[model samples]
Target chain A: MAKQYEFRIKGLPYLLVLPQMVIVFIFFFWPSAQAIWQSFFLQDPFGGQYIFVGLENYRVLFTDESSAYAQSFWVSVVFAVSVTVLAMSLSLFLAVQANKKIRAASFYKTMMIWPYAVATLIAGVLWLFMFNPNVGVVAWFLKHKLGYEWQYLLNTGQALTLLILAASWRQMSYNFVFFLAGLQSVPADFIEAAAIDGAGPARRFWKIIFPILSPTSFYLLVMNLVYGFFETFPIVHQVTAGGPGKSTAILVYKVWRDGVVNLDLGSSSAQSVILMLMVIGLTVVQFRFIERRVNY
Target chain B: MKRFSLLMLALLLCASTVFAQIQIDWWHAMTGKNAAALEELTKRFNDSQTAYKVVPVYKGSYSDTMNAGIAAFRAKQAPHIIQVYEVGTATMMNAGGAVYPAYKLMKDAGEKFDPKAYIPTITGYYSTSKGEMLSLPFNSSTAVMYYNKDAFRKAGLDPEKPPVTWPEFFETAKKLKASGMEGGFSTNWISWIQLENFSAWHNQSFGTKNNGFDGLDTKLVFNTPLTLKHLQTIYDLSKDKTFIYGGRENKANPLFTSGTVGMHFESIGGYGNFKNTCKFDFGVARLPYYSDVKDAPQNTIIGGASLWVFNGKPKEDYKGVAKFFTFLSQPESQAYWHQTTGYLPITVAAYELTKKQGFYDTNPGPEVAIKQLLNKAPTGNSRGIRFGNFNIIREIEDQTWEDILAGKISVKDGLDKMVNDGNAELRKFERLYKK
Candidate 1:
């Protein structure tokens, strides 16, 4: 009799997030849990029999030298960091240019984002054609036009550079979109204030604009690093096949080769769990140490 | 009332008789030109006799088709026939009661199937350990060298003569590259053609007991000086920009046909595509060897896939499949298929018929593959690998080869690592079965 109860006010947040939570549970969490469970068992593909091996699989994962899981981890770290830095630098430069009143800005925007709209697999295929020593456009240009001897497939340094470039090319667009949005959100009044205080354009950008955009930069850095490790496999397989030797054999590709192609679920799963823990720990450290410095 | 009841009963009997056309499903991975031929064969069979209707379904690539079949089987809805690659042989063989061997099925269905009628080499690969045919060899191919005639002419080399030894191959490729060709040489399935088949072609064991002939206890043994020599040459060629390594697998097929590469090593199954696509004349030759083994001409191993009959089909459908197998075995049909597609004649009779027809004499290219295959009888290792989880072993080999070419690891260490890793995979597979 005293108080009227409101149904909409208390349960609104839950209602808003219920669909996404359900989706995450079903698609991501459930499959991950199942893979973890399978890592502990030996599965018979013929009869669907799974026998638990306790920590035997984990022990094998640690002791398997032929797999070189440790080497893969190190390679992945280097690949992730280099790709993140390169992609971030490029995208920031593009965003800054697009923000200014430049000629054909709209056309430039479309051209910059065009690669992002293409599928990763298709991009790999196109890149492979361009790098083909026999018929690749770039190979033709390098050898015939420039008169420099080049074979991207056989050279280790060149192959790795090609992988980084292809990876960065696809990623820079996503970074550009985020940076552009962040740039737009940066208050014009703040830049004017900095200028009035006798700061130059470069100084205004470095001190005033960059610090405000730190949050977006940080977000892009973490996401890009994770993607460089985990998501670049299909492209790598299509493009280099992790060659001119194993120069491009990063961690996720190793896990994929061990798991799907090799059918050694135990070692592959063990690698997956370790990789997950490493990523999670690194992410936590970043948030603890770096998140505080993000101005937003 | 009695007359009306009798009439109704008669009508019910007529309705049940019309629903008796036994339906059978076949899931295959044959696509492009091969698919067109398969459709022609199935259509002719369907029109010839109306006893049973065989429905053929295209299910993408070999691995994709097999995965789909396995999933469907678990769902209790697998096709009557599934085309599985040779690598999946051990998996199917270990799948006890899941598959009905062709001979057993034919016999049980009151059909005659003499396994001896097939080529000994062809049947041997698909047979059980006891020499019983388990599956039908549908489209088998082996690695062979394809050279551009125009490139050879431009390089001032003999068009009819191909490199018989590895040294000659390298020298010739270098010459072609120097003559301003796009690329002197490019190879596909570098792992399979250059390493796995290279070891087998030389009669060297890639693993113990001729690449796991004895079973899961097999260990790697390919870290030899000869293999090192072969790999070192490839690395040197890359430095010289004479020999180009294609991306992976059949990625280099188009390079040869597009006139971008002077010479290429690819599967004979790709012959159909090459023949159609190559604007300039091209020729086929047997794979080159290192000129060391006593009996090095022991024939190149096959690369294409075979068809396996699965269980869970109706009794009447087995009869249709067996009859279709017999029809496909006819010499004229085999010859036609061999001439149209670049796959080998699957039977001795087909080979004889093709020779009598002077098909090889007219077509110099198709004869090269046959002469190479029949050059020496296949032994255990050269016959083909059928180890449990051999697919994984192939992947490990692929990774190891990549490492070797990258200069990240020496060939000896790379192959040694591959062997150790491959054996571990086999042992894990062995453990799964044992436990």
Candidate 2:
């Protein structure tokens, strides 16, 4: 049965919603508007002088290959996709195993979620130390014992891989928590019936639990994409700093490097505007396509 | 008892109202021991005067400090002073009405100021075409070669003798390698130490318009044969691991400190950090030159930050800032700063004071940078690079250098690409602040 609730006063409803709207406008809309506005003008870092340059900032970014903003776009795509797929699948697997009624399952679940507590930048630093070529425990083992060279310093692929691993490791816990909840909520009877009907464990789970977990999966997918794009900036900043040579300069880091570090206000603003549009387009596409598959 | 307590409270209020110290906020980028030294210096300044309290706030890295200073200026809450790195000089100088020129501040405050009293090379960097000082030269450093004496010993080379020329440096590197060192040598700051200073050291122009001093529309001219040959030598060395490419910036520092590399090039300001970290006996020497070029091994340019006064502060605050700057320039204060931190003493008096005290006898490492800076009177190109968007340009240079070394691009092509790309950035800067 659906329960209908009504506010006592019309003014009360507006009052209740006013604070959220104001917060959103101040934090999100206002800065976004400013970014869009600033994109049209060239200004010094001090905001002392502003010259209107039309769309020159955007033109420079799009045309200048050496600036590497275009390269950052592809880097971000690979980074986001790799991070999303890797974190999602690994967490799903871990959640599935932890879903069993084994002894110390709660302890195992808690241990898996511990990485989620580390801040992104801190996690990056931790991962950097662990994978540092000079004197890292893992790096030492790989070099001395396995005799496989693991130098991320100059290797673009290895650097990106290490960053992706660090990024995915921190996020796995959050995905695992959601996946475990989704797994626990799956009706046991449906699973049992599918098993009784001669469907194997893989088929039964795929047909039954997987589709039922679609809602969670869709939500995680969108969140993970956003996380991959924006939240991974700290990790990228700390780990490689877009280095080995602009090989990992993702979009967000470019925006920060230009705007904050180099004080290129106009270009960074343009970048942020483009980044905003890109993410918005991405979210819209996800909801349109991915959400349609999420039954119930 | 209540009446007596009320009387005491009234007295305290009167005291607070009567004696108010003008708080001069000094935002700086110095960290660790340098920051501690700055704080102590600030305490000394505060103790010496009752009219002003100079509070030195450590504002992250140099870039972060510059950003914060600029952002705060926009908000009309700017500090009295901010330390800007040498590369940021162009950006800071171009910000009209955003900064109060140091000479003007000193003149207006009626302070006994003489720009020539400071080291010519130091003041020459932060000055205008008229040779008027723009900002107070605070902490300056130059590139120097830090050699591991133990590695030299292991290589059977004389520990006291370091390479004097580029060819000799490479030869020593070969010797180190033959003696079984993992990496013979490496360098830090591919863009700064290697290219920019490399040009100046060899009496060559890094860019046109006297390295952006004459005009904003400066074009890079460092893609010459000399620069190319230098890069080629490093590239060839890197092929055999005689010269290990240590990522970018100071990332190669660990290679030297790890003791596997014999000689490393870095800022002399790294003195404090190296002392703390290096387990082996290390010695600092002048950066090697080609030795074939005329006036080769000319004075190197300064790195590190300078104290810049923000615009639009109250008149009294500017006066206090002027006074505080005067305090920092005193021989004792400058010598202390020079000794405590690895940064150079900007004034001749401080340098003489330090020498007389025989500070160089024990800490000869820092003297190399000082001597490098003062080796010869600065020429047009040797004054150091001053171009806007240099931070971004440095990144481009770093990326290009790495690409060339990694064999992704040929040395000539990479240098050409760097020049082309860097010129575009300079054009952007020229357009932004074009008069």
Top candidate, metric DockQ: 2
Stretches of model 1 off by over 4 angstroms after superposition:
A1-25, A47-51, A147-149, A272-296, B1-19, B166-186, B199-207, B223-242, B253-262, B289-292, B353-362
DockQ of each: 0.33, 0.70
DockQ versus reference, model 2: 0.70
TM-score of chain A of 1: 0.84
* Pairs with backbone N, CA or C atoms under 3 Å apart (clashes), candidate 2: none
lDDT (10s digit) by residue, model 2, range A1-296: 79977988879988989999999999999999999999999988877678998998899888966667778999998999999999999999999999988999999999999999999999999988788776567877887789986778778999999999999999999999999999999999998988889999899879999989988988898889899998899999888888777889899998998888888889999999999998899789887877577656
Measured over the true interface residues after superposition, the C-alpha RMSD of each candidate is 2.9, 1.4
- Candidate 1 yields a Cα-based lDDT of 0.78
Taking all chains together, the TM-score of candidate 2 against the true structure is: 0.96
Best prediction by TM-score: 2
Please identify model 2 stretches exceeding 4 Å from their true place.
A1-10, A285-295, B1-19
Give lDDT tens digits, candidate 2, residues B1-435.
Answer: 999999999999988854587889999988778888899899999899789888888889888898888889889999999999988999999999988999999999999899888988888889987788999999988899999998899889899999999999999999998888877899999899999999999889999998989999899989999999989998999878899876677878888888868999999988888999999999999999987899898899888888899888779888899999899999999999999998999998999999999999999998888888999999998987888889989988998887786678999999998899899889989987887
